[model samples]
Target: MALTVHSRFHPIHTDLAVVTLTGDVDISTAARLRDDLAALLGDGARHLVLDLGDVSFMDSSGLSVLAGVFPLLRESGALALAAVNPRIREVLRTTGLTRLFPIYTSVDTAITVLRAGDDAPS
Candidate 1:
């Protein structure tokens, strides 16, 4: 199935964006994902929290997109993953990405961490 992305900026933290993706993140959709996320980053979204609760599958292209954006976000803020499924988490773990981004139990928890201001990771 085609990927569906739902992105929204937090009401209180305007620069923090919560993006949720559903469906596979493969060659077909990876470019779109990258462009959409790059747009958010360019639009002043320094902090990004990805709600992976609904994401079913991902490939290297997807991982590349996630890894590629980390540097930009790191310059000012950081990225967080929320509600990651076991299979996807395993992929992240196998690739040692668990060290790169913090994973939270929910979108709210991730938002809370990001909203903590400078205390949040960059």
Candidate 2:
């Protein structure tokens, strides 16, 4: 499983979109991720769960793509990361981005957490 990027649709109890990062996400693939995120947003998919368990490597470029996407999703309050790799997690932690996004151990947990948020009185 080299680092690659692919997306899948996950129709859970609520609207769920799963984007899985497979291969290395460096400068080479950063744009692809960005495009994917933008496409999802354009398609009216506010709820996005990025599954990063298959990613073997990532760099600033990859991080930038995520940073860009987070705000877009936040505008609608629907986005999360699921099963993020430890290496990527470490990078995010070191950069203090862990607090910027909601991360969960799995997509199921993410959905549960998001659903809870939806149920909470604003």
Candidate 3:
């Protein structure tokens, strides 16, 4: 099955956009993923989190989408991955992107971290 992505915006202390993915993320849906994510970034969403707990499969194409967004997110100091399964994490690790971004075990963790960062004194 092809990947289906559902995106929603949550009003956290800091601006955040969460996109949840389900089904297989291969060549067929990688472009959609890229477009949707890039749209979010374009809309001024700085803090982004992708919840991939429901994604059954992913490929290099999916990894490419993630990688392509990282630098753009970094340019504004935002973006992270949340609720990624071990299988996908392995792929991210193999791509040497594991340390490039913060990986959280759950969406709650991602929100908490974001909230904390927002609350921290600068």
Candidate with top lDDT is 1
Error of 3 at 99 (Å): 1.0
Question: Per-residue lDDT of 1-122 in model 1, one digit per residue for the tens?
Answer: 68998899888789999999988899899999999999998888999999989889999999999999988888779899999999999999999998999999999999887778656465
Taking all chains together, the TM-score of candidate 1 against the true structure is: 0.94
Q: Between candidates 2 and 3, which one is better according to TM-score? A: 3
How far residue 37's Cα lies from its native spot in candidate 2, in Å, is 0.8
- CA error at residue 58 for candidate 3, angstroms: 1.2
Cα lDDT tens digits, model 2, 42-87, are 7767688888877788899988988888777776667788898888
Q: Can you write out model 3's per-residue Cα lDDT over 10-94, one digit (the tens) per residue? A: 8644358888899988999999999999888777777888898899788889888888888887765567788888998898888
Among all candidates shown, the one with the greatest TM-score: 1
**RMSD in Å for all candidates:** 1.9, 1.9, 1.5
* Comparing 2 and 3 on lDDT, the stronger one: 3
Ranking of all candidate structures by their TM-score, best first: 1, 3, 2
Clashing pairs in 2: 3-22, 3-23, 3-24, 4-22, 4-23
